[model samples]
Each structure stands twice: as structure tokens, then as C-alpha cells.
Target: MKTSDTTDDLRQKLTHELARKRALLIDRHPNARNSLRIMLTALGVTDVHHAGRSVEVLRQVKAHHFDMILADYQLEDGRDSQQLLEELRQNHLVALSTVFIIITSERAYHNVVSIAELAPDDYLIKPFTADELHGRLIRALYKKHFFAQLYEQLDNGAFTEALSTCERLLGQESAFLFDALRLKGGILNALGRYAEATRVYQKVLEQRVVPWARMGLAMALRGQHQLAEAEDVGQSIVTEFPEFTAAYDFLAEVQQDLGKPVEAQEVLQRAAAISPNNSTRQRLVGDVAARNNDLATAEKAYGNVLRRRRGSSLKNLDDYSNLTRVMLDRGHAESARQVTDELRREWRGNRQGELAALIMDSLCAAKEGDAVKARHAVEKAILLHEALKAEGATTRVSQKMTVDLAQACLATGNEATAQEIVRQVAAENHEDRAMIAQVQRIYSKAGKAEKGQELLAQVGREIVELNNRGVLAARSGDLQGSVQLLVEAAERVPNLQFLVNATKAIFTLLELKGWDATLAKRGLRYLALAQTKDMRNPKVISARETYQRVARKYGVPIVPLGPSRSPESGPG
Candidate 1:
């Protein structure tokens, strides 16, 4: 039969079915039943063009600004039921409130099982009764309304309020208890309330070992700097739910933070193997490989991203940046230049991207022996960073960038300017070990190894002296005096690893030897500061464990603070 004739007959059938079910029909197809047309004469819905194929009609209705959409999974264009549902979701034409129904034959059940991505609000198998459709539709719409407020708060990033709404719904209706638990856990995790989040996750684990709940709990533990515990939980999760991609992602992050780059790369590789279609996972694997200087692996990963290019958007500038750097390392300077040029053109207006592009440009110019152009680009890069700082951009153009500019200046024989820039940054960040290391490396590259070593030793001695005074004050039995001395010491050397580490040791000793509640808390504050200074340090790890043990010994219920803030943020 012709599509038009078939649609006409189906429209009549739908009219009879709606009357049989006592429900209204808002068909998007142009075909209308003579009986339905007469029936609509009494009702409303005068729009006709808004009413042909279900998928296109829904898209048109959205552009035309309709209140709701009633779409069947099957359409007249020989598209299967699942494709229609996927299209709606991908296009976001189906809002959280939008009601969708799948019209399928019994044979489509096997097809439905094969399709992992399509999800409809209601599914109607052929030979289903009209009463079943009405009952299902009413339930879906009512549930949508019930969760409307919760959805609204989440969309607006008011995660705490979303948790409150979930609590209210879960109390009044047992049916939504699991959903409430999930939402509450998610919000608590986002807010860095990991200890409380762990409790919520424990409740979820009681019912079932959900991968998401397991991953959430693991993340909370990781936030607490409890890497061993997080790794244990992640291992269990991946073993049981090997297909869960997020579990591997979290595992990779925790492993990388714990200084296990090879393990992290293996985890990411396993995840990519299981779900080979994920471009982001491919990119991450590439990054880990590139960091290890595994150019071959990095190239393969970048090739995957290039093959699936989403077209000239700044979709993943880091991947392109890393790719170019890898190419440069491999001595494929032309390929490196080509990638940088593409990114430069694509991200011309983005200040951060422009800076990155400028850095790459300077590097390229230096390689080509164009000292004049390299000097200009490096100067431009520094000015761009100054502009960003003035505009209060949250992104930091790290002190490393300053070091780079200095190196470029030095290379071009602008020794006075290079020396001045390096001196300014070194003086300003006198206590930052990583920045110190970077400065030393830059000077060494410029064949000034003795000067770099002298600078590093000078900074180290200043930090050691500050810490010694604080320790002497603490050892004098002046607990308050000790804390005051240490606090002042920390302020003076906030970014110094040795100074921060000493502060942490003092706090640990105080927690063990004294019984002051405020002092114990203060100890935690310092331990967090130490961890921030060197997150993966074995000494920081031991100090944190000692602090936690002391807190538990006193029954103080010390909440593990989430991801340590930068030491410069100070004491909070």
C-alpha cells in the first residue's frame, strides 16, 4: 500500500482507538480522519501542517514552539522504532517533561534488546489494549510533574536544593526512594561533602552494588586522600562490573594522582578496549602515552581523534596541543606546525587558546632560526597573559609561561630582559618548589647551570630557617605559641615544600601529644596545606594518615576535606 493511503487508514484507526481509550489525539502527521476532523470541530488543534512523519513533525513542532510532542517510535520513512527515539534524545527535542511512546510489533522486542541507546517513556507492543496505553501515559506524565521541581534545580546547578527536593519526595513516596538516594549522593559528591556522601553511598550499596554508587564512594575516598581505600573499592567495582566505563575513568584519575602513571594508562586502555567508540577516552589514553613520551601510542590516539574530527570547533584543544608537542618531540616539525596553525585559526578569539597558539608559534619560530619572529611571539604571549590577569580570568598562565618567555628572550640574545623577567617571577614565587624546578631547568637549558643551582639552594635555605624557628617555639611547651609561630611561618613560606611539610609535622605532634580540640583541627588545616604543596609526596601521605588517626582517637569525626586547595589560598 502507498504511504499516504496507509497513513490515512492508520489515522482513522487512531481516531477510533482514541475514542475507545477516551484520550485525545495530537497527531503530527498531515493526514486526518474525517471522523477525527469532525471530532476536532468540537475540540481544538486547528494546525494541520504541524500534524506528517512523527520525527520530522516533532522537529518542526519544536521550531514552531509547541507545548508538547506525542511521537510514535515507528515512522513512515521505513526507519525503525529505535532510530526515532535516538533522534529525539540527540536533538534534545524531548524535554524532561516530554512524553514519548514506542509503537512496536512483538518481533521488535529482539530489536529493542539489541539497541542499547534508545529509551522511551512508554512502549506499546502490537495487539496491546487501549486501556494499557492510557494507564501508561497517565503514569509517565504524573511522574514527570512530580520530579519537575527537582529537575529544574539540577538544571540550574542548585545541587543542594535538588538534594532537599529528593529528600522530600523520598519521604512522601517510597516508590522514588532509590532515585532520591541517587540524586542526593550525586549532589553531596559535587559539593565536596564526601564523608556524608560515603554514608549515602553505603545506603545504596545495601540494596545493590550499583557501579555509579561504587564509583561515587571511591571518589569520596580519593577526595579524602585515602587512595589505598579508593583503589580497593575501584578494583572491586571493575571486577564485577567490567562494562562500566566510568569506573575505569575514576580508577585512572586516582592512579595517576597516586603516581602510578603506567597503571593509569593500563586502566584507560582497558576502558578504551571495552568501549572503543569513546573519543574522549581515546584522547585521555593518548595524553598518558604522550606524557610518558610514547610517541607511537600518542600518534595512534591522535589519529583516532583526527579521524573522528567534529569539525573546526575547539572540541578538545588539549588533545591537539599535546599532539603537536608529541610531533615536535618526534622531530616532525612540519606536522607540529600544521596542527598549531589549525588550532590558531580555530581559537583566534579565545585568550587561553591564543596564548597556547602563541607559545607554539614561538617554539616553531625558534626551531626555524627566526630569532626576530620568536622574540615577537614570546613578548606577545606575555602581554596576552597580562591582559587575562587584568580581566580577572580564573585560568592561571602559570609561572612556567614566564620562564618560557625568559628562555625565548635569552635564546634571542636579549639577556638583560630575560634576566629581569626570571628575577621578577623567582622573587615573587620564592617558595614554589615546582616553579623553582622550572626556573632551574630554564637556566640549565641556557647553559647557566651554576646560577640555577645557586638560586635553588638559596630558596631552600630560606624555607628551612623559617621552619626551624617554628619547631623551636613548638618544642618549648607553648602550644598556643607554637601554633602562632607555625601559622606565621606558613604565611611566609606558603608554597615551600619543606616549610609546609614542617608545619604538617608540628600539627601531627600536637595532635598526638595534646588534647586541645581547636589544636587538633588546626593540625588538619596544616596537613591539608602540606598535601596541597605536594599531593603525591609519601611524607604528606603519612602525615595525613596520622592526623586522621588522631581525629578518630578523639572521636572528633574529622571530615576529610575534598581535593586540597592551593597553598596560596591558605588555611581554609
Candidate 2:
């Protein structure tokens, strides 16, 4: 394929394909964008768009999909190309099929590999000719075309089919064997076949010391609950490749799970220092620091999170509440009030924003000793919370915000309301140790640590009893009764465990008693809810596979597992 004649033939074909595709050029300077647009046009890419800022690029991506995106290394908003690429992929704004090329100067090119946590398909050095760009575009387009079927399956959430495609490619495509193995490892990990995924990654590592393969091996180890071994590999990666910021994040997660909060905070802080503009890592630093009772670090991290995302589309109500919570904790009541005011101004008509603002206002007023104002704000917040719950929008509210509301209720002498709110939250998130710790901290602040313990124990018991009843019924061969109990539990609590259980149970019943459209729909809804919580959970994947198998057997349509989104929200 690398022979001159074959390469020429492929380039000719790609040139024809380029004429029918759309492209986007992103550069801070107008002249640079124009020059790139001309080069693309010369290469037969006439349907070209240009953006001068990262925000503009985001807007264009949300409004329309492009076949190719070429962004300069440095963006106008202080974000580098790597950060933009990461954000787009993480939020599912861009498809894997899109060809992304970073255009970097010689000086920046040397550091690109070290700094990039999310690698682009290819990169072009500055001051290159149209022929050079054409050469790179043709190669990237060819690879993209080769994996088109696999990407389609992935985008559709058909993991099983995607895995099969990877296996086929691995056996046949000598040029793309490594690439197929990489995709196969990721798919296996996502489907929760950690043992097999571990083998795939290990096989790759045996051939060469690829960073991605090592990271995949670490993740596969983590999935198998081998936290100690995973931590060792993660530490080695960061030590050997200090510029790999993602290793810092992975190491921190492993440390946190291993009951090393101080270590976790330190690792995250290191990552944040290396990549200061990553709002997600900054938020994680804030969370871990707060849990460690390092209020000063927490305050700075949360402030950075808010500042980085201030005007971006990724900004949300939780950002405001996160900063305000730390500010109030640090006794910066006035500063907290200022942030709340900003939140109100930024989110004027959004109901969730109003709820967040009122809750923050109540906390600030309480901190300032204005009991009357605090009580008034709490009353308003309670009403809004009830309205949202009645409208079935409670899931839209973040767990952190719910904790803040409970804290506000406790501050304003509405102990009963606070207890009930915490009870419901505790019931739903009993498995999340961090969230439970947060709930306990709220109770401890209100001088009811003992009561919090009692309430959490009671919630735990109730959940276990509810789950056990369903399991026992299923064991006794009463599948119908088991489904009924599990469905009721899921509707009542809707936690990941219950939702997965209910979905699995319903599909089992359907397989036995013939498919009932109503029952199948209910099961699919539960599966979707579980995916929202954790898309890669082994149980969720198993449930999804079960539904697919049963649907195929009955010749019914199988719904894709991708999340539904509006046009404004970007690609599904």
C-alpha cells in the first residue's frame, strides 16, 4: 500500500471523495484560516467552513457535522487543540468517524505528543504545501473508511457487533492489525469482559510498549478489581511519561478507591497543574480536596472550574453551586453571595438554575446571621424542589445540589424536611461511598451525626430487604413475582442496582412468556435509565445484550442504546 503507484491511486480516489465532503478550519488568525481554506479548496474540498475561536468551532459542530476538522494548536480562548478534542469526544459532540488533524508549528510539534491526552488522527506541520496536506488527508481518509463499519456499530451502541467486526479485521487486515486490536480491547473492556480485554492488551504490550496499550491494560486490571496492580502500572506510566496527564487522573481514581484520599488529592492536583484548563479534572480536584477537608485547595480548584467554563456551552448550574459551596464553607459569605448573583444572571429563566440560586442564597443568608432571609430563601427553594419532583425532573438535579438543599434545610431549622431529603438521597445512592460520606458530613454539621448514622443504616437495610425479596422469589421459580417486585423497587428508588435488576428480570420474563410490547418497553426504559448512570457497567451491558437477543428472536425492533439528544445538544 505504501508503494508509489498504489499511493497515487488511493490519493486520486480520496481527491474525488473530498469534493463531496465538508471540512472545518479553525485558527485564531483570519489569515491562517483563509490560507487553510484555500489549500483545502485546492485539494477539492470546496464545502469548507471556518471558525476563529473554540466556541465558534463548538457552535459549528453542534449545528452541522463535518467530514474533516483542522484546528490550530493554539486557540484564542487559552485552550489548546488537545483540550478541544477531548471535550468534543467526552461530550459525544463529535463522531469517531470524523477526521481531526491538528496543525502545529515546529516548536509546538515537539511537545504535542507529551501534552495530548486525546490524540488526533493526524497532524500537519505549519508552512506545508497543498500537496503535503493532500497526502495526509488521503491517508487519514483511507483509515477512516477502513473502520467505517466498526465506528457505525459503536455509534449505534451495538457493542457485540462491533466486537465481531474488530475480530474480523484483526484476522484479515495486516496493515490495520494493531488498530483493530486497540479497538477490540476497548470494546471488550466496555462490555465488561475484563479478562479477555486484559489478554488483548497484554498481547499488544508484548509486541511494543505503547502508551495506550499500557493504559488499556491498567483499565482492564482495574475492572477486574486488581487495584494494587493497576496502581503500580499507573504509577510507572506517570513516572516514565510525566507529560501523560491522563495517567495522573487514572492513578488518582485508583488511589481514591484504595482508601488513600490524600494521595488522590495530590495526584489530581499534579494533573491540574499540568493541564490547568481542563475543567473536568479541576472539578475532580475540588471534589477530592473537599472530601479531604482541605478547604483552601478545594476553594481554589472550584474557583478554577467556574472560571474555566464561565462562558462555554459546557457550563451548568452545578458549577455555580460547587464554587459557592466551598466559598461558604470557607466563611466567604459575601463571595458566595456574589457567585449566586452571577448564577442568577447567567441562568435567568432556567428553573433548575433558580433552584440552585435560592439554595445558595439560603446558605449565604444563614452564614451571615440573617435568619429571616435564610428562612425565606429556604421556603422558596423547597417549593421549587417539590415542583421539579412532581414534574419528574428530580433526576435532572445533581446529587451535590440535593446535598446542598438538605444542608440549607438543616441550617434554617427545618430538620424534618432535611432528614426526609437526605433519606431519599441515601436510599438511591447507598452504594456510592463518597456520596454517603457527604450526606453524613451534612448531618455531622447539623449536630446530628448519630441520627445520620441511624438513618443510613435504616436505608441500607430497606434496600437490601427489597432486593433480597426479589432474588428469593426468582430462586423459587416465581419469575413473574420477581419481576413485579423488582419493577416496583426500580420505580420507587431507581438506583443503578435496582434498575439493572429490574431490566434483567423483565427481559427474562419476556423470553419465557413470549414478548409483551408493554413489558419490553418498560424493561428498555429501565435499561436506558441504568445506562445514564453508568453506561459501561457490566450489568447494564449484560441486560442490553439480553434485550437484543430476545428482540431478535421475536423479530421485533431493537432500539439502539445511544442517548437521545436534541439538535442543539450535538450528535447522539
Candidate 3:
């Protein structure tokens, strides 16, 4: 086992270089951090930080630029390092230059989500020595450096430069040629150049079958609305690599789009079986399950969401709210009341939470045949709604909470309140034919279909007038006036197509006239409200793009429309 002096010298040099590398070690266990510290120290790494929680880890990454992040897959939080990486990437919190190497104890982690698809730098199993770990890190660093220009452009959201860089580097003989091609495919897909992306992915596939490349091909096809072909590709990927969670998720989305929600549910259920603890996955499972009228499955999925929320600060309150909603639907009054009680306890001082719990109580009371209590609950809810409005809560968010309030109002014989609530919903969603229909059905179920139609007509007329005036304002070179009129009109009826179009027109006017910071902000605010109504609305999507373009042109942060919520006004 004799080694040459030259080999020893090279090892010493590599070790010295690694010592200067800034590293961050993240694990929930103190012992794990200590162990990793020792291992990394052996590699001559002197600068390192340890974080036992994601919040702290994120704080670290956000505060300092780390060269390497060695994260344990299983963090104390409900999410793993993969989820952490996702948050970091999606929010642009970290540069792609930072090498992320995830460490997991179980091989099963590999089957849950595709590391290649998500593009984490590397994956390692437990019981690895410093040298093996170092070897992996070296390759990852090499890859990161080799694709520096592409990553630089990508991190800056410079798709054109990224594509050009990938193209230039792709035809040359390089160790990272396949990686370059993958990056090119990703850039093309991001730009919605689907046919070119398909060719790039196919080229990678011809070189060798890769999970990420196959998934990219499926995604490009889906982008082109080639649902059947995308499904085939997605199904094959999942069949061949059952661990590819993205494929399953994509396939399920395609199925839902194709009106095969039941199939989507099955696909997600399988993914859940493999990665049971992912809250987002569980939430999606609940949504599809509920959509398909599989209440039992839906309840179980939301219950899973609730359980996962217990220890995690990143709680989605909708899980508790939806749990109560469906429990009432299933005629489980006691269960619904208990869930509402838990929600109240969990969010004791929250105004919105208090209102939601009150709404749920009314539902439970009605289900339990307590008319007086239900009516009183509705009255209390009305007061809470007024109180929130007094505290500056926008009334334009026509979501499930408001729908539940309307439903509670009707259940409690508060017909006037019910009419006003449904009317507001109709006003906001004047252009959403489906939602308008749902609102009509809401009244029909309560024996007020004709009245509902009249209210919708009244509100629709008001929205149309406002929209028409706003269009005239924009056309007259009154960009600010147009923005004000359109945003106010949109807010009056949060999800109206007319108002959405008006916002888009205002955005265009602003674009032509150059950015007015306040007006552009207002435009985003209006689009965000519209998104809460129907994110898939074409008008909303177009306005969102326009808003981003203005934001980018103005050198401001492109405000992302807040989270897209589950439809609150959908047919029960």
C-alpha cells in the first residue's frame, strides 16, 4: 500500500484548497452536525456553519453567500432538504453557484423525487467517508464551474443569454456537454420554445436515457398542449422510474386538464405512498380527491395535511378550514365542530381565523339542527366580517371563506346578508362564466335562482360601465386615471373578466407611457386580486405578464401574484 510522494503532494494541495472553501452543514441532529464537522475538518475545511433547522438554515443562506451546503435530507421540519432547495430556488434566495449536496440515510428517498429533475448538485447516502464525500463534492463543483456562464445567466433570469451560452458550449467537446444540452433544454422550455426543447431533450435521450431529460420532454409536450403524448411520456417515466415524483405530478395535472380527475387522484395517491409527508403533495391530493367527490379520501388527505402542520411553522390554514368544510358536508357535525374548535385554539388572536372558525361553527350548528345557534353564529360572522373590513381587509377576495360566509348566511335565514355576499361574488367574477353559474346554483339550491340572476345582472352592468370608462380613460392618455378606475373597478368585483381586461389595457397604457411606480404597483395589486378569483383566467394571466414586464422595465422586484387558492365558490 505504498503511495508516491507526488500523489501525497496532490492530496495535500486538494486538502488545502478545500480548507478555504466556505461550507454550511445543515442537520436537525446536533450529533450529526458534530460528526459532519469532524468529517469536513478532515478534508481541511475550516470555514463552516451548522444549522439544525430550515428557518435558521435559510437565514444563513440569505445572510451569507455559501460556497457549499451539506444538508441532511431529513430535517426537523416536516420538509426535507429537497423542499428547502425548492424554496431557495423558487424564491431566488441562493445562487446556483452554491453547491448543494443532500445527504440521506435511506435509499427510499431516491424514489420519492428526482434529484436530477430538480437539479440539486448531488445526492449521497449515509455512512460515507470524508474522501467519498469529497469526491462527490469535487465533481459537483466541477460541474458548477463548468456551467458557470449558463448558471450566471439563468440566475439573472437572462434566458436569451443562457440559451446562447448553452448553444455555444454544446457543440464543443467537453466533459459537461450533456449537462450543457440539459441546460439548453431547460432554457428553451422556460422561454416556451417547446419544439426546440423537445429536440434538445430528445438529443440527450439519444445520448443516454436520463430521468431529467425524459421529464423535460414530457413537460415540453405538455406545454405544447400535447396532453396525450405528454401523458404517454410521463406514464413511461413513472413506470420506468417510479421514484420520479415530478413525472407523477405532471401526469396528474395533465389528467386533470383532460377531465380525468379520478386518474389524477390515483397518480398522486401513488406518489403520496412514496413521499407521504410532503404537505404540498398531500394538499394537492386532498384537492383532487375532493374534486372527484371522494370525501373519504379527501378527508384523509387533509387530515394528513393537518397532522403535518402540527409541528411545522409553515402551516397552510386551508387544511384545517377545508377539513371542517368537508366534515360538515359528510354530516359529521361533531367532527366539524371539533376541527373548528382546534382551529380557533390554533389561531386564537387571528382575525381571519376567528371569522373562519365562526363560519364553520355556523355550518356545524345548521348540520346539528340548531337553528337559533346557527343564526347567532351567522350574526357573529357578519360582525367579524365588518370588523375585518374596518381593519382594512379587502372585500374583493371571492374565495371559499366568503362563499362559506354566504352559505352560512343562507343556512341561518339571513337572506339579505346572503344576497349581498353572493352579489359581491358575482360582481367580482362577472366574467367567470363557471363561477357565475356556481353562484346561480348557490341561490338555486336555496330556492332563489331568479333573484340570483337579477343580482348578477345588476352587478355585471356596473362592472361593464366601470370597465368601459376605464378603457376610455386609458385611450385618452390618462394612464393614471385608467389605472385608478380599472383597479378600483376590479376591487369592487375582484374577479371580473371585464376588469381584468381593463387592468391589462391599463398596463399596456402604462408600458407605452413609461412606468408610474404607484400605478404599476396598483396594477399588480389588482392582478393579484383577480388571481384569487381565477388564476387560470386568460385575462388575468396576460395582465400578470404585463405587470411583470413593467416591473422588470422599472427595475423593481417582479411581484409574484400571491398563492393561488383553491376555488371557494366552486359547486359544493
RMSD of each: 13.5, 3.5, 6.8
Model 1 misplaced stretches (Cα beyond 4 Å): 1-140, 157-160, 306-316, 345-355, 368-373, 383-572
Tens digits of per-residue lDDT for model 2 on 14-120?
77889999999989999999998888888889999999887898899999888999999998767888888887876667877889999999888978877677778
**Clash tally, candidates in order:** 4, 0, 6
Q: Output the number of the TM-score-best candidate.
A: 2
lDDT of each: 0.61, 0.86, 0.74
Model 3 lDDT tens row, 1-572:
12233534644454556877899999988998999999888877879898998778878977888889998887874677877776666555677778898888767465534533355777888888888988887777766656677776666445556678788887766677777777777667666688998998898888799777888898789889999999999899899988767678888988977878799999999988877767778888987787667889989999989988774556655778778877876778899888998989987897788888888888888889999988898899899898777877845322557777888887778889888887776776565544565566557657788887888888878877877888898789787687677667666655556556656866787778887776666666666666665553435555665666666776878654542211111000
Model 3 reaches what TM-score against the true structure? 0.77
Ranking by lDDT: 2, 3, 1
- lDDT, candidate 1, equals 0.61
Tell me how far the alpha carbon of residue 422 in candidate 1 is from the true structure, in angstroms, after superposition.
9.6
Candidate 1 residue lDDT tens string, 361-419: 77677767788888888888768867886886613445555666676666666767777
Q: What TM-score does each of the candidates earn? A: 0.54, 0.94, 0.77
Candidate closer to the true structure by TM-score (higher is better), 1 or 2:
2
lDDT of 3 at 368: 94
